[model samples]
Target chain A: MDERMTDAVLATEELTVRFGGHVAVDRVTCRFRAGELTAIVGPNGAGKTTYFNLISGQIPATGGRVLLGGRDVTRLSVAARTRLGVGRAFQLTNLFPDLSVLENVRLVIQSRRGRDFDMWSMAAAHADLAEAAEAVLERVRMTDLAGRKVAALSHGDQRKLEVAMLIALDPKVYMFDEPTAGMSVDEAPVVLELIAALKAQTDRTILLVEHKMDVIARLADRIIVLHNGALAADGPPREVIASDVVQEAYMGKALEDV
Target chain B: MLKRILSGDMPQSRALGLILLAILIGLAFAPFLFPGTRSLDTAARICVFVALAASYDLLLGYAGIVSFAHTMFFGLGAYGVALASDGMGRSFGALAAGSLAGALAAAALALLVGLFSLRVRAIFFAMITLAVASAVAVLFSQLSGITGGEDGLNYRIPRALTAAARYAEEPFLGMRLTGKVLNYYLVFFGALILFLALLRVVNSPFGRVLQAIRENEFRAEAIGCRVVWHRTAATVISAVSAALAGSLYAIWLRYVGPDTVLSFEIMVDILLMVVIGGMGTMYGAAVGAALFVLAQNYLQALMGAAAEAAAGVPGLPLILDPDRWLLWLGALFILSVYFFPTGVVGRLRGR
Candidate 1:
């Protein structure tokens, strides 16, 4: 962690979640700084996704609280958190399969701009909204597929669209849970490039939970390794990957395969 | 129509809207064109149901909520006018105030139900509404002093709306512009304006979010929509529209009864209207309501005569009996589901 960058954009104070007796996420505390790319990598059942869910307000916390920009947002709904700028891309492909790509992106932009409740106005009548939607599509290189339905898009392209939606939201903190989890070998890097471009494009803080090491190594400036449900190691990527604890517990033979 | 379709995102609705517009115009001049009591009555019923079914679609088709409490709100509106006119003297002001009261009450009930039950599973939401509606129906029936019990309520409307009253100067098509004619036009014009307003609502930005929520609630919520609130608003809007339809029905019939407006059969009729016409398609409601009302009026008589004529035949008696008309309707519904799986309008639009 940089000393001058002491202001935490997202912080979990002893965040805990348990499914009955099974502790999915056990008392984890960490601070994500502004404008830095952080990766949460671990073996399967590491509770990385659960941690993301807690912060994104996808699920209620059994214990502890979540803070964003130094404000307590633990009890807020997923939508409330989203309005306050916590954007999430799900592990599964979560785009609206029935709606057009442009519509999907436009809904995100509309939600962020608080125009979703405009019942009397035509959706296409707003020029600013259309321009904003088009701008996000251009940024994610999906302007060509704007008219196409989300279900018709390729897996890689759909992933890009999800990122495009987050961009439309213009969230201050982004939480991506295994964004490239289901992609083919060729398609994985294309998604990574899109996500990687997000860092350079905006000064938003990003936290991603990824299984693959190479993708994490390429994008994450800082890495947090998890074993079971607790943080095993947290530091600069080079130092964290070099630690004996991460090597012994989670990343031992995993790094070798990559 | 072409300009509206081009300006709106819902292209398929244009055809449905035009068809409904033509039907409304034809019904408005039914006395002039097709002069008969039965034809006039059927036309008036179509107007009432078009509003009811279309409002039901706001919840069922657009918001994707299955509510069985619709006719409860409908009955409340009829009773609202009947009771207010009876007590406050037969005046148009009293009728309008009563109908407005009914609409507001129904909206409040819908909001309360939505706030509590909308958070549950979809099927549970349906079951909760059905239970509440049944309870309200029972309450209306048992309160004989206020609701007139099983006999129902019959009260005089304003003098100009009474059956004998007529326009003294200009006769419409050699016939006096009687109260029935005035009532027919009232229902016709009222249903049209409300239906068009509903079309405007479903085509707006708010309606798009409703479609989104119907498609995927989790995704909708994650995208910053207040899902429960949206569902609640849909319920209120739908309830108010159904109540208005009920008011029209009461005024046209000059009577309000449990069997006529508050029964589960009426709810079933509304459901069939949406399903057969098509869910989520605004125009389908009008088509469905018109077809169903026409069949109910004409087919019952046709089937009864056929059954009476075929009384000597062995199996024909059982099959063609007027009471077994539901069996024929069931078969037709099944065939409709099979052939026009998306619905009449949905299929017409090639969706």
Candidate 2:
């Protein structure tokens, strides 16, 4: 990875998001470097998803600022943030169940292509849009299932389709939450390969929240550990995993349940 | 091949072309097949309800928000036309402006309601809308001066095509519209145009994001979809459609009243049409409307003799009356909920 790419694609300055009385994420500051795959690892309730939410502008931060390419976007709406080149994929699959895989990708591509409000022209006539969606499908290895309904796809394939959707947006930064949550051991490697390939091919920054340490160790260029809504450790995988606090956070009897 | 066609990957243009062709053929030949006052009247009524049903589907089916207050918008449009055109002697343009005013008013009301109610999901949202509808009905009943109260407002039929003919100096398209046939074609064609426009909107990127919001709002927001805006837009669009249907009803009946506009029956009928036809599918609205009208017509005919025979029982209300159709409609709703959860057409499509 280029050292200049570490100038930061997305950065948070003491960002805090509170839900009623409980603080979901507390004064967490971090920077996602461009062209690098960064992993946020923590147990359940550690606020990894909430942090993602704040960065993506899905939810407003109670305190501090979210900077995208050095521009403060704390008050921006989700769509506005998307327009600024932030793409997100949810932990649970969010594809339109009735629409086919190709249509799902086509919708994202259409939005990116800036023809969302075209009422008179037939969307099917946009051969370039279809080709763009097809390219994303091929990237995710979902070209074979493009014609199939998303509901008909297996759990792993659906995840790939979700990735395809994000790819169609061609966003500068991608935030994925639990990308391989329901995949089998055999299927997990395929997704890992896709993510690796995505990182190698594009200068886009990747922020991932994952539980599978092996997958994290394999893909993460840097790892940030969150425990109880605060950053516990930050460094390379070897350095962070060896920290006593990180081990205690994971191996503690009470924490083990999470 | 059928699976591929039904998969929604097939461009909507091709499917829409076939549907439009079918509708054009049907509209062209329908007058000759029906050739009678009763048949024409039924067909016109179907068109009116189809438009109303399609609007309701836009909200409940596609947007996944059940709004029982839809009939309030419909009623407002009817009353606006009555008050503006009939009461004030305004022209067709004024009537249209009045209808648009009513639609805007409904959109404002929906925005207010959605601000609080949209926070609640599912049955709670439904209850809130129902409360709004009931409250509106009560207000309309109490405000007799504006709504014409129970007696309703009766007036002359507004000249729809005659003005067009006079302006263009066309010979009324060679058909005397003094009968119901012309009204049927007019409403049917209007309904067709509205349906096509809605189909385009639903297939657009805007509609896809709205569906994504419906599926998972939080995720959609995370992905940069403005969930509130999309939902509100859907509500406003639905209100406009309902308002247009209301104006058409006022024109067709040559009357407007609190009973016609503010009735719980209209809301229930719209719900039945969307649910029984299919929720979410474009054609579900038309299918539901057709089935509902057909069932009502036949059921009333069948129950007339039975009600007459049972009239000697003294206290029993006439089951043959159109008002009594609610009971059967409620039964059908329950049946649809249990057996055909997705709707009749939805079940057939195996969705």
Candidate 3:
């Protein structure tokens, strides 16, 4: 990883999202530094997911701006934003369950290669896409299950496949929502290792939304806490964890439990 | 590694191959089984419904957009063909013109409707399509002069085909299509071509993008897919297919009426067919259409003369009437939703 974090890959300014009468995300400004892993931690219904959604363009913000590498992208569509090098992983595994693991990655490769509209040509015939898909799967240590249908894979494997798809996009920034949501202790470490490996390979910025403090402590270079649609604290993990506001937000719950 | 293919594989390819073989055999031998004029007519009618159902499947099953106004396109095509060929005194060119007009009309409606309805999910979209369908029906009913009022338009056979038949002393080739076999084959071949074309489209990258949209529209949009454009393209393609089927219906029936064009029954039939066969599978449309047509035919046959006299069965209760087909269809729809959520093909593929 590059020692110099000189660039801001993703920056949010007064970002807010509202659903009808309820404010899901309040005005918040934050910047994700390049070559750093940042975690967005919050209690349930704290708007962490909502913030992620706004930044990723899953839902348009009611007010505020989002910038990707100094370029304003508040008006861009989700797809346009993605093409401009922003990738996201959903909290719920969003995959073509019937497709093979390799086919899943191959689809991302196809999109990246700009062959998404070639109707007459077979996707399987694209050797470069296949190679890139395979390489990403190998990076995630999922090559052995490449031919297996996504539906047949274990939850952990499916999560790995999701990460592999994000990696295939080769985005300048990756936003992950609950990356270790349903993993066993052993499985969580594997995913953490994979994320670390991704960080090592590229100077890409990462915004990880996680409930697991251990994973956050191990992976996050900086941490932000959200409580009821507002920012509770922002600092390094140790400082944020020790903050009185964050502890109150957790209702005196231990950081380990969080 | 070799064990992978034989042991625990989904067997999608094998299943698809078998289904394709079955369809090929059925299409090849349909004329032999339905040798009479009525039988051939029925087969042609089935082809139109199959195409309509397939088009519906593209939007509802594959793209996950529940639309009830698909019949609008079908009706438009039917009326367009009738107006061009019969009313306007045009010849073979009327077919192309009618299809293009219907598609453009439907595409325009889809764009307008999709703009608002696409923002809402599931039930809202369904209700919006229902509203559109109902509105169109009312509009056509009010426009009696252009739409031929309640009596509808009477479509005459093209002069060219009759002249050709007279010139050749037979129908088209030396083969006498004085029967329905020729018409059946013609429509069946058209449906087959459409089915194959759709199969190719669904398997390509373009198709993959649609599936991606279906799986997660937000994720798809984030990945650089223009959600509205992709959806609009699918809608237009589906509308064109429905219009083509409608044109075929107009040609086969040699009559166009408001009842056939504006009825909600056509929409229900298409939906039931797709659901019964399977959603998201290529063969689902054909399977659904076949099953629906056969069931209706059998039920009507069992009802016999009494049903024809009053459009209601004599021996059975009111539930067995021709209109009561919806009750049975509704029951099947519920059962399929509960027991086979993925439909027959989806369940088979699951195993």
In the range A1-258, model 1's lDDT, one tens digit per residue, is 455326888899889999999989988989987778999998888899889989999889999889988899999999999888899888777878888999899888888888877877667787788899999898767789999988889887887788778778878898888887666677676667777877886578899888778888888989997778888888888898888878777888877654
DockQ category of candidate 3: acceptable
Off by over 4 Å in 1: A1-6, A184-190, B1-22, B168-171, B304-318, B321-323
List per-prediction Cα lDDT, in the order shown: 0.86, 0.75, 0.76
Output the number of the TM-score-best candidate.
1
Cα deviation of B284, candidate 2, in Å? 1.7
TM per candidate comes to 0.94, 0.82, 0.82
DockQ of 3: 0.46
lDDT of 3 by residue, B1-351 (tens): 422212221227567557655755765665565454555556666677878888888888778788888998888888778877765565667766766677678777877887767767778888988998889887777788887767777766555443234333444433344424544555677777776666666666777778878877766766677777777777777877787788778866766776887689888888888988888876677777876786676556654444566655455655556667656756767887688777777776763
Candidate 2 residue pairs that clash: none
Model 1 pairs in collision: B61-B280
The alpha-carbon deviation from the true structure for residue B256 of candidate 1, after best TM-score superposition, in angstroms, is: 0.8
Please list the residue runs of candidate 3 whose C-alpha ends up more than 4 Å from where it truly belongs after superposition: A1-6, A16-27, A41-47, A92-100, A147-152, A210-220, A223-258, B1-33, B160-185, B302-344, B347-351
Summarize candidate 2's per-residue lDDT along B5-85 as a digit string, tens digits: 322323234443454346446555555655555665666667778788888888888788888889998987787777777
Order of quality (TM-score): 1, 3, 2
Q: What is the lDDT of residue A251 in candidate 1?
A: 87
